[model samples]
Target: MHAIKIRLSQEELEQLENLAGAGYSLEQIAMYLDVPKNDFIAEFYDLDSFVNYHYKRGLLMVDAAAGLALAANAAGGNITAHQQLEKIRMAQFVEREKKRIIYGQETP
Candidate 1:
């Protein structure tokens, strides 16, 4: 089945990214866009789709912001932030190790 493509203006695309970065769900985003939820879901059925790509990019923006905040706080000697940063580092290490084990040393 062919997927329906929605043409979005640059402004709309930025709006989508901002909304996604603010942690809006797909259904909520659809409402904000004035599109039916099912249509939005159908258009963004896969990771490769532009909508989903923007969504994930938005999430990455949030991750980057949070990481920066955590690092800044840790640098300022906030004990709780330091512990949180360490936990994040450990989780990232564990994820990399799991990928290495599953995909061998060839894993990036």
Candidate 2:
């Protein structure tokens, strides 16, 4: 069956971002948006498209919020938060190094 493409309105775009930020899976997001899974996938199939861009931006938003909270807790002497924050930093560094090796030094 051919999937019908649906364009999201501004309000739906906002909902999509919020849902993604809340860690909803793609299938769940589709259901919440009242869209068929296949149609939703069809609309967002391009990773470089606006749909994916908003999705990733949403994920980054949550990551940033969590990191901020962790930093605050670590500053207040939470040992667990400190350790987790350090682990995240180390992982990010490792990922950057890997990217640099694979895609040259200019990778962001």
Model 1 lDDT per residue over 5-101, tens place: 5766677777888999998999999899887788788767766677777888888898889999999999999999999999998998888898899
Candidate 1's error at 66, in angstroms?
Answer: 1.6
Q: Rate residue 94 of model 2 by lDDT.
A: 92
lDDT of 2 by residue, 21-80 (tens): 999988999899898887787667776566677788888889999999999999999999
Q: Pick the lDDT winner.
A: 2
- In model 2, where do residues sit more than 4 Å from their true spots? 1-4, 103-105
Worst 10 residues of 1 by lDDT: 1-10
TM-score of 1: 0.77
